[model samples]
Target: MVKINILYASTEGNTTSFVTKLTDIAAENGDIVVARCIGEETDYANETAPFVAIVPTYLTGGTGTGPEVTEIFTNALGDYIAFGRNRQYLKGVIGSGNRNFNVQFNLTATRYAQRFNVPMLFAYELRGSKFDAEKAYHIIKPLFGE
Candidate 1:
């Protein structure tokens, strides 16, 4: 069985939605996809099993006190990726941008993705509540090569 981890950190449910879509797609294809919040710890027997992280970008600069959501997952996955033997098991989604909805954020998420070397995908341009879920799916799907 092909197992995949879909981890996410979302404050306003935006990033959560994205991760949901990712998990759903992977599940539909017969992959054992696991989705969880950043704070939650999961047990995966396979160190090189595929993993994906989804983190949200906030307009404000404060990172939530707890492990910054994405960081927790990245740090966990990074260990496996750093070994240079698990390239196929790493992927990620960055929640940022949404111009039509007037949502703006610092985009620290992109940097996090870079740090882990996981493919990054934005939800939408900076805007206010005008997030297009379809667009987000399209953007994130490529990272999974869906």
Candidate 2:
């Protein structure tokens, strides 16, 4: 069976909700998914399985044109990957964001994918849509030769 680890953090729970959907799809497809929620107080571990990261775009303005765009909100998520050997095991990233944010939508996941030299596997708005989880599974399953 295909196995994937997911590392994520949620602020308003949108990121958590999206990751949950992915996990549900993986289960229905007979794949193994290990979902880990990382927080500032969580201990770090060197990942042994290929993993995906989920991050949400948090902007100061609803229009995303404000000057308050900052990385401070998801510092814990970034720190989790920055820990020993975690970066090496990252397979890809799936981003959730407000599309109303214009070019800033899903920017966090895009940045992580680029930094880690991995694909930005999937993206969707808050908590994803009815079919987004399934679509994401199809995209990622082939990467593991499933």
Candidate 3:
């Protein structure tokens, strides 16, 4: 079985709930999954397994055009990617944000994907739906050569 690691950040638990559902889906597909909250004591830089990231965008400077990522995510993931620690690993990115924010919606995930050269699998909204979970599963299934 392929091992998939999911690193995530959530301000109000929406992203956490979404990740939980995605984890269940990945497990059902027979992949060994490891889910870690951003601030948790996990060594993302040293991870050897392919992984996915789920981050949420928040309005910054009172403008939708400028969004800020959570410190927990930026601190951990920034160092991991900036230093090219996980550059050789296959990865995906998923972002969550409020649609009302318009231009800033899920932008954080987009940035992370570009920075890490990973695929942007899905940009889910607040409290991701069942469809998002299914999409996540489909994206990860093939990584195991299934």
Best model per lDDT: 2
Q: Write the per-residue lDDT of candidate 2 for residues 88-135, one digit (tens) a residue.
A: 888888888888777888887887787778999899998887599888
Candidate number with greatest TM-score: 2
**Clashing residue pairs, backbone N/CA/C < 3 A, model 3:** none
Q: TM-score for each prediction?
A: 0.50, 0.87, 0.79
lDDT of 3: 0.71
* Global CA lDDT computed for model 1: 0.50
Runs in model 3 deviating more than 4 A are: 40-45, 62-75
Q: Which is the better candidate, 1 or 2, if ranked by TM-score? A: 2
The better-scoring model by TM-score among 1 and 3 is 3
